[model samples]
Target: MTAAAVACTGLAYAFGDTRAVDGLDLTVAEGEVFGLLGPNGAGKTTAIRCITTLLPVPSGMVAVFGQDAAGDRMAVRRLLGYVPQQLSADQNLTGRENVALFARVFDVPRRERAERVAQALGAVDLTDAADRLAGTYSGGMVRRLELAQALVSAPRLLILDEPTIGLDPIARTSVWEHITAVREATGMTVLVTTHYMDEADQYCDRVALMHRGRIRALGTPTELRKGLGTRRGAAPTDPLPSLEDVFRDVAGSGLDDSSGDFRDVRSTRRTAQRVG
Candidate 1:
C-alpha cells in the first residue's frame, strides 16, 4: 500500500547567518518517483539533509515513513536509504565487496546478504564487473556500484541527490536505465533531486520546482508545462512548453538570487498572526 514516505513542514536551515532552506514544506508518496528540481545552490541539498536527518531542522518537523526524524532517527534511518551527490565508496574495495560492506553494516542477514548483494549488483547491471575493484571501473560503473550499495538494505524510502551529475550522455542514460529498472522491479519510493529537466520529466511521476528555499511549483510534468499557458498562437499550439522555459518565465532570470523575500513574507505573516 502507498504511504507518505517523507514529510517536512516549516523546515529551515541556515549557514552562518544566511538561511538556506527557509520554511520549506514537502511531501513524497510511496511507490512514486518524486523529483526535486532546482538551480545550483538553491537549498536542495540542505533540504535533503534535514529529511535524511543528517542535519537538524532547527525549526520544523521532518518525518520518514511516519517516524519522526528528530525523535526516532535510528528507526527512520532503518527504513531510508540515501545516495549523496558525492560517491562514498572505498577505492580499494571491489564492487561486490562494497555492497557486502554496507549490507554487513546495515545488518542484513548473512545468508541473505550475499543473495541480496548479487541481486542489487545485477539490478544495476554491474554483475559482470561485480568482482572488479571499484577504482578500476569508469565513472558510470562507480555510480552503479554506489546504487547497488544503497539498495542492499531493501529500504522503503530512497533519497538520491544528483545521482548522475558529471557523467557523459551515454553514462547518464545508463544510470537512468538502471534506476528505472530497479525501482520498477522493487516497487520502492524514491526522492530524487536533479538539475536535469529532461530526466526529471521522463522518470518522475511528479516534480517540485524549488527556488530560493521555497517550492515555486509542484505538479506532473504535463501539468507544469500546461500551467505555463499557451505561447502566442502561431498555427496550432506547441502543446507543451519545455520545463526550462517554464522555469525561466516563472523566476524571471533571478532564480539564483537568495534574498529570502519569501522567508520574510512568511515571517511577517507569522508575527501578525501571533499578535492578532
Candidate 2:
C-alpha cells in the first residue's frame, strides 16, 4: 500500500487549560481532497496548525508524506503549503510580489523564482492584476493571491483553513474552480477546513465532521447524508438529508456553548468583515 500523504494519530494540543485538539486520528491519501470540518472552536484550526508544525504539542503524532511533523519539522514543511484562516498576503505588496516572497521563503531556486512566481499567479488568474497592491484587490482577488502564495512552493499537500471566508458565492465558486484546476493538474493532496457544507459536498472526496475536539462522523458526503437519514429513521423514499443537517446532528447545533465562545465569534466576524 502507498504511504498516506498525511497521517495523525492521537494528535492533541492545548492552550493553557483549554484543550483545543484532543486525540485526533486522521489520514489523507495522496492526490485527493479531504475536508476537516467542525463548528467554531472545534479544534479544526488548531489541528491544522499542529499538522503544519506552527504549534508544538506535548503528545500525539503528526506526519506529512511519512515525515514526522514533530521530529522532522523541516521535512514536513517542505511537503506542505498552508493558507491560514487569517489573512497571509501582505497588503502593501503587489500580487506578483506577494507570490515572489513565498518563492523566496520556500527557497525555490533563485534562478527559477521569476518563472515560478509568474506561473503561480497565472494559475489563479491573477496575472492581469499582478502589479496591483493586494490592499486594492477585491476580497476574491486577495484570496486568490494568497492561494498563489501557497502554490509558489508546489507542495505535495495543501492545507487550507477557511480559504474563502468572506467572499460572495460567485467568488467562492471561482476560488474552488482554481483549486480544482490545480489539483487536477498536479495531483496534489488537499486538506481543507471550511464551514461551507456545499463546497465540501462538491469538492471533498471524504469529510470528517468534528465536534468538541473529536470526530463525530467521517465518510463521503453522500454516505454521511444517507447515514443521517437512516439514523433519523427516514424511509428509503424520503428526501436525502443535507450535509447541514448532519453538521447540526453531530455538533449539537452551531449555538452549542461547547462549539465556541465570544472570542471565537469576534474573530470570525472580524475576518468576515475584512474580506466582505
Candidate 3:
C-alpha cells in the first residue's frame, strides 16, 4: 500500500496559555485533495504550520510523505510546497523573478532553474504576465503568481491556506481551476484550509471540519451532507443539505460569517458587529 502524503498523530501546539492545536490526528492520502474546514480561531492554520515544519512538532507527531516532519525538516520541505495565507510575492519583482527566487530557495539545480520557472508559470496560465511586476497584477493574478512560485520546485505535496481569500466569486473559481488543473497534471496531494464550504464541496475529495482546536467531523462532502438529515423540517424531497449546512450542524452556528484567518480577530469582530 502507498504511504499517506501527510500524517498527524497526537499533534499539539500552544500559543501562550491557549492551546491552538490540541491532540490532532489526521491523514491525507497521496493524490487527494483534502480540506481542513473551520471557522476563525479553529486552529487550522496552526495545524498546517506544524505539518509544513513552520512550527516545532513533537517527536512522532507529524510526517510528510512518510518522512518525519520534525526530524527530517529538509527532506520534508523538499517534497512540500506551501502557499501561505498572506501575500508572498515581492511587489517590486516581475512574476518570473519571484518564481525564480523560490526555485533557488528550494535548491533547484542551477541549470534547470529557468526551465522550471517557465513551467511553473505556464502551469498557472501566467506565462504572458511573467514579465510584469507582481504589484501590477490583480488580486486573482497575484494568487496565481503565488501558486506558480509554489510549483517551481515540483513538490509532491501542496499546502494552501485560504488561498482565495478576499477575491470575488469568479476570481476564486479561477484560482481553484488552476489548482485543480495542476493537481490533475502532476497527481500531487493537496491539503488546503478554507472557510468557504462551497469551495470544499466543489473541490475536495475529503474534508475535516475543525472546531476549538479539534476535528468535529470528517468525511467526503456527500457523506457529510448525508449525515445531516432534514434538520430544519425540510422534506426528504427537498434539496439535499449543502456543505454549509453540514458545517452548521457539526460546528454549531455563528460560522457562516466567520473568516478563516484567525490572526485577524479584531477585524473579524468589527466586521461581525457591523453585519449584526
Candidate 4:
C-alpha cells in the first residue's frame, strides 16, 4: 500500500501552561482532500503548524510522506506547500512576481523557473492577472495568487489554514473551484482547516472533527451524519441531520464562547446559504 501522505501519532504541543494539541493521531491518504474542523482553541492550527514544519514537531511524532518532520526538516519541506491563515503576498509585488519568489524559495532550478511560474499561475487561473499588483486584486484573486505561489514548488501535499476566512460566498466558491481543479489535474493531497462545515461536507473525502486538542470524531461526511442517528427532542418528521448537525453533536457544547466562535457561526451560515 502507498504510505500515508500525512501521519500524526501521539502528537502533542503546548505553550507554557496551555496545551495546544494533545495526543492527536490522524492519517491522511495520498491524493485525498481531508478537512480538519474545529472551533476556536481546538488545536487545529497548532496541528497544522506541526505538520507543515512551522512549529517544531514534538520529538518524531509527525511525519510527511514517511519523512520525519523534525528529523528530516528539509526533505519534508520539499514535499510540502503551505498557505497560512494570514495573507502572505507583498502588496507591492505583481501576482507573477509573488509566485516567482516562491519558486526561488522552493529552490526551483533557474532553467525551469519561468515555465514553472507560468504553469503555477495557469493552474489557479491567475495567468490573466499575472502582471497586476496583488494589492489591486479582489480578495478571492489574492487567495488564488497565494495558491499559485504554493503550487510553484509542485508539492505532493498542500496544507492550507483557513484559506477562505474572510471572503464572501462568491469569492469563497471561486477560491475552492481553483483548488479542486488543480487537485483533479495533479492528484495532490490537500490538508485544510476550516470552520465551515458545509464546505467540508461538499469537498472533503474524509473529515476529522477536533475539539479540546483531540479528534473527537473522524469519518466521511455521510458516515458522520449517519452516526449522529437522531437529534434530541426532535419530531420523527424532522429532516435528516446535516454535517452541521454532526458538528453540533460532537463539538458544539465544548466550544468556548468567544468572538471567534461567533465569527465562525456567521461564516458557516454564509457558506451554507451559498451551497444551498
**What TM-score goes with each of the models?**
0.88, 0.96, 0.91, 0.90
Model 1 alpha-carbon miss at residue 268, Å: 35
* Model number with the top lDDT: 2
Decoy 3 TM-score against native:
0.91
RMSD in angstroms, all models?
9.1, 1.4, 4.0, 4.5
In model 2, where is the ten-residue run with the lowest total lDDT? Answer: 253-262
Q: Where's the lowest-lDDT run of ten residues in candidate 1?
A: 267-276
Select the stronger candidate by lDDT from 2 and 4: 2
| Candidate 2, superposed: residue stretches over 4 Å from native | 256-265
lDDT per residue (tens digit) for residues 1-276 in model 1: 544888898998888777888899998988899999876656888898888888876898898878998898888888977888766767799999999999998789998999999998998999999998987888788887888889999998888888887677888889889888878888889999887888888899999988787889899987888777555333344556788777676556654554444553454344233222
Ranking by lDDT: 2, 3, 4, 1
Per-residue CA lDDT of candidate 2, range 1-276, in tens?
A: 778998999998777667778899998989999999998889888888889999875698888889998998889889989988778889999999999999999989999999999999999999999999999999999899999999999999999999999899999999999999999999999999999999999999999998777888999999999999999999999999999899989987555554445665677777778889
User: Tens digit of lDDT per residue, candidate 4, span 1-276?
Assistant: 778999999898877666778899999999999999987878888888888888998643888999998888899999989987767888799999999999999999999999999999998888998999988888788888889999999999999988887788898898899899989999999999987888899999999999878899999998887667653544657665888888888887755642133443565455334323
Candidate 3 per-residue C-alpha lDDT over 108-179 given as tens digits, one digit per residue, 9 for 90 to 100: 999999999999999989999999998898888888899999999999999998888777898899999999
What candidate 1 gets wrong by more than 4 Å, as runs, is 230-236, 254-276
Instruction: Give the least accurate 10-residue stretch of model 3, judged by summed lDDT.
Output: 267-276
Residue 163 CA error for candidate 3 (Å)? 0.4
Per-model lDDT: 0.81, 0.90, 0.87, 0.85
